[model samples]
Target: MLENYLVRGLLIGIVFGVPAGAVGILSVQRVLSQGAAAGLVTGIGSSVADVFYACIGVFGITIISDFLLKNQHIICMLGCMLVILLGIQCFRKKKVEKPASVSHKKQEDRHQPGTIRYLISCFLSSFAIAITNPATILSFMVVFSMFRIGGNESIGEDIQLVLGIFCGTCFWWLLIAVVVSHIRDRVTDGFYLKLNRIFGILMVLFGAGIGVRAFMV
Candidate 1:
């Protein structure tokens, strides 16, 4: 029974994480700019937010969920603005001229004095972007209902499910980071610039769509 709960949770997590939303674009951009570690950290931040929403669903925290749903439009507006701003930043970001080896060394040095700051910035940005979408809880609720989860379940079972979700989400992010990092060295600066512009445009379009939806709701 525990295994069933865990496996279901894992599947749901992967399904949720697989979408190439703003968070996904940010993760890929970070991988191209910084390294695999940056991308993974960004994804971890998003995963943390996902776990928070998942907890609300698993524990049936109706009060919080209700409140979030009530103000979903405002939350979505904020998210839209945030995403658009990030998209602009991505679009305007200057390409790194230094060779990969030099950049890698500099990145290594960043670990010495600025590691905590860098990590916090990356993590918090993704978390903020993710948490603003209060609709995520609704998605969780729907998915949970479909899976027949969280109703009169033991605390132990719920905990197992949540842990499985975390593991599954983290695994997906790690895979993305690893794959992107492997190709990081082969890509030229021009390619990186082009990708940045492309992703930036996509993010802005995504934000615009969200904004429109927010108003329609």
Candidate 2:
């Protein structure tokens, strides 16, 4: 009973959420550097992906299982693209000067895009990103499926498990945001200039490498 599949899913979310949480530092850094719109885009994009992966793990594993196996190279290519795009964004700098009125917190926070828009877009972006990498779900499916009981099921119990997992995942991201918000000062305007050039070039190189490798294959 203790080693049940539901309990296992709960644990998996807890564990994976940790490193994913850790990288969140970079996510927050990216947000500060990129601006709220971009940061929300990236964050929600990843979050949506995680949610999709969660669904695939529970429901679409069989369908996704085969597609992933057949298109492993394409998957790798997509992953490369995502990483590069983020890197490019991470390093890039804006030329246009935001007015003092816009930059100032009291005015800026209120005048900016609505929170709902930010949230919806963020969810969509993360969801699409996660869908592209079904492996995340597959990995989870493998673990939870391992613990699946071959008897009567409880829908109520399943819901509880899922909610727990999501909360666990959120905990990880929230922790990341906290740490990142702390060091936002260190990431200055000057740093962004050099960072962008380096990451932009490297990201493209990474994409090129993936294409070259796939082409060879």
lDDT of each: 0.85, 0.54
Highest-TM-score candidate? 1
Residue-level lDDT of model 1, residues 1-217, one tens digit each, is 8888899889888887783789899898888787888889999999999999999999989999999889989988998998899999899887563236465677567667576687788899889888988888988888888888757888888988898888888888899899988898888888888888999998999899889988987
Question: Taking the tens digit of each residue's C-alpha lDDT, what string does model 2 give over 33-87?
Answer: 5344444444545654565566555554567667764675687567657656655
lDDT, model 1: 0.85
The TM-score measured for candidate 1 stands at 0.93
User: All candidates' TM-scores?
Assistant: 0.93, 0.65
Lowest lDDT sum, 10 consecutive residues, model 1, at 95-104
Cα RMSD for candidates in order: 1.8, 4.9
After superposition of all CA atoms, the RMSD between model 1 and the true structure is 1.8
